[model samples]
Target: MSRALFAYPKQAQFGRVLPKNKIYEHTSPSPALKALFVQQIDQIVWQYKLAPETINLPAKPAVPEIQIFDITLKTAELDHDVLRCIDKAIPFPIIFQLSHDNRIQTIATYKRPSEADNNKWVIDGYFADDWQPIETPRQPLPVALDLQGLYEQLLRRLLPLPPREQEALKNHVERLAQWHGKHNEYQKLQAKLNKEKQFNRKVEINAQLRRLKTELEQLS
Candidate 1:
């Protein structure tokens, strides 16, 4: 019989689930519970026809368990609600079998000690095959970032730069941040322009648009 999946807390005790009222407190899972979850995840991998090698299951029950799921090509574009459901159901780190452009990639999402602050959770990397670490650091929880920002930071870290080049890159990043702020302003102006039917008000908006466009061009 298939076992029910449990939503384990990140800092929970090793063996068993904490009481619902005290869920946020740090605790660990028991050895038996860890083994059972690992077995259940393994069974799911088999049922989905996903390669077991893509998953980086711990060699021993002593290690923290991570939930694994094989996302097939057909289901690669899973809707937001479905993805949210999956995320809610799984307690441990999640490994995804992602298919894109006829290529199968193993993407793992595991929590790591936050560099900026220790008492927070951060999804550090998207590991490749054999759990090879990918440097994709993200912001801490509660104030999460969009995937675009995450991938942008990943791409930025792909190569090392010289001292002077690093300085230039830092300036460029600052400029990009400014551009994003201006972009938000531009969007708001466009929205206001769209709703305002009065000719005089439209003329004022058009002037503001021209100035914002000029600033954006300077940034570019």
Candidate 2:
């Protein structure tokens, strides 16, 4: 915590003059509504690799130029009635411009909470930096859609490892995942393949059958 935050000093009791009051409101919304909105914005953040930064804002974000990204409002929770009723409220990265009446106007508006703590307003000036790809490893998107093909692709990348190496790698990977608080399904499989490739081994079902037959013949 900043010393300014913890120290009030002699008589500045109404609270120190931080511009935080001029920025976004931090009131908690309904849990369901809050989760619904946050998830939608977080998707955009991940897709665009948008770096989250906190800004002190009070009003809703202003309107900004139209964005090219395809943002569908298909989630059942976000609809016209649920969203449009708030006054001057919109999502972030909005563009506000001076109008003919000498008043400012927003060309485009997003009005939902931002990608950060879900409380700040994203200003056009702040979002001016072009977006980059999100390169860091991320948890797989929860099973809202099919991921079989994606998982297969990852497996293909791992199928070259040898048996012993695969075993060690798989165990190592599982242990690493345990550190992160959850098991990663695909990574574990990848680790196995990596081990197999390292040992130059491949499982052959017919060969295993022939081995069993030889063992029975020896017993006979």
What tens-digit string does per-residue lDDT give for candidate 1 at 175-215?
Answer: 65677789899999999999999999999999999999999
TM-score of 1: 0.34
**Candidate 1: global Cα-lDDT?**
0.42
**Residue range with the least summed lDDT across 10 consecutive positions in model 2:** 1-10
Which prediction has the highest TM-score against the true structure? 1
lDDT, model 2, position 62: 26
lDDT of each: 0.42, 0.27
lDDT of 2 by residue, 1-220 (tens): 1100111112212222212112224433456655554543222110111111111112222222111121223332232222322112433332211122222111222233347756555321111111212232223312211222222222222222222334443343333333333223334544555566434343543344455445433322
Give the true-structure RMSD of model 2.
22.3
Going through the candidates in the order shown, the clash numbers are 11, 27
Show where candidate 1 strays beyond 4 Å.
Answer: 1-97, 100-116, 119-154, 157-178
Using alpha carbons, what is the TM-score of model 2?
0.17
Candidate 2, position 86, lDDT: 19
For candidate 2, the per-residue lDDT at 34 reads 51
lDDT for 81 in candidate 1 is 30
